[model samples]
Target: MSYPHHLGMTVLEAGPERTRVSLTVTPSGLNMHGSAHGGLIFSLADEAFALISNATAQAVAVETHLSFFRAARDGDQLVAVATPERVGRTLATYRVEVRRGAGGEVIALFLGTVSRREKPA
Candidate 1:
């Protein structure tokens, strides 16, 4: 089965040591407060983490954390950029920065730690 959940979010780039992604805000994506939901932001960051972590090999997220600095509104084009902070044989860490691409404003910052999995013998 395909992992369509991540695909639906429109992740743009996946490569060694980095991943670039974007999410466009829509009416249906907003919360009761009329702002982009934290879950959405987290999902965006998590997707970036997954892409970057697995760039070299298969990996799994062991921990993740995010801090939101501003709210995103409908029609705002949000982009997330992930870069490797540390890469080891067993564990890897990445930093993701989410921003409003249209206005170049910072939206959120995230950190993710992933563990590499051995290939099945």
Candidate 2:
């Protein structure tokens, strides 16, 4: 599995059309409200979708829908699991759920779509 190291995040697992990802809350990873930033959570979800979408080949982001259910504060661990919802020749959709670690309280959910690129000739 390939682990992607990005600012404020890290990829925990990458596999065929699926990923298990996590990130820790840091001082800089917070919003004006002193909670984990929404963008950071979304980024983690995006990373999971990216890993799953391009696990086999090339893919590009098409669209995504996300909702924040609860606030993630400092010291809280954020984990996301991405699963394929639909896989077609041109497009793929994935559903990702973000949860609080240890207790498994869902904090957010994301539905992402990607466009699959044609293989090299």
Candidate 3:
């Protein structure tokens, strides 16, 4: 199974330039502070970034940065939306916003860059 599937993440929508993914925090996904682990939030953001970045071409992550704004706890539903900030022949940048729910409080912001790869002839 895919890594996202293992994390119980669902892709709500997907396109070449945009994507939406969701996940519900489980007990195992929580940190010692009784909130969602930063890694879990990052993974959700990364999954959305990966989906949108690779929709039209093969790409690999070059760098990623995530900023946390709020905490989420067990049973909290989170949604991550990714959109391209820029796209070029060799490099692309994306912005991902992770929210508490459909329109809930902002949980985190993620910025990522990927290196595009040529498709096999």
Candidate 4:
């Protein structure tokens, strides 16, 4: 978890099966269009996914699918919430929504699945 970029993300909540993180869009997170870049949005979702998916067990991301609903600009505070769709012994799915903190409009939707792995023997 040495990703320096994530150091800027603030953890709002961390529960056993759910989590929330927030961040304000900055210059480095913007694209040529002056809007938040897709990668940064995706990272916001991914961070939530990582927190919720591994809340109770060891898991690794197997697949992730995301859809952008709206564009967010610099200085916009964004919050991401991750909820579990299913939690099984060997598999899990989470739904992450990135929304503008001020208006609560979703800017990105992310669905991620993970494979739970047992401890090595």
Top-scoring candidate (TM-score): 3
Q: Assess candidate 1 and give its lDDT.
A: 0.84
Question: What's the residue-level lDDT of 121 in candidate 2?
Answer: 59
Off by over 4 Å in 3: none
Cα deviation at 100, candidate 4, in Å, is: 0.5
Which tens-of-lDDT digit does each residue in 1-121 have in candidate 1?
Answer: 3342543466677897668888788887789999998988888888888888887778998999999999999888888899999898999899999989933888999999999976565
Candidate 2 regions with alpha-carbon error over 4 angstroms:
1-6
Name every residue pair that clashes in candidate 3: none
lDDT of each: 0.84, 0.85, 0.95, 0.87
Whose TM-score is higher: candidate 3's or candidate 4's?
A: 3
Ranking by lDDT: 3, 4, 2, 1
TM-score of 3: 0.96
- Greater lDDT among 1 and 3 belongs to 3
10 residues in a row with least lDDT, candidate 2: 1-10
Clashing pairs in 1: none
lDDT of 1 at 95: 97
Candidate 3 structure quality by residue, lDDT tens digits, 24-81: 9999999999999999999999999999999887999999999999999999999999
List TM-scores for all candidates, in order.
0.88, 0.88, 0.96, 0.90
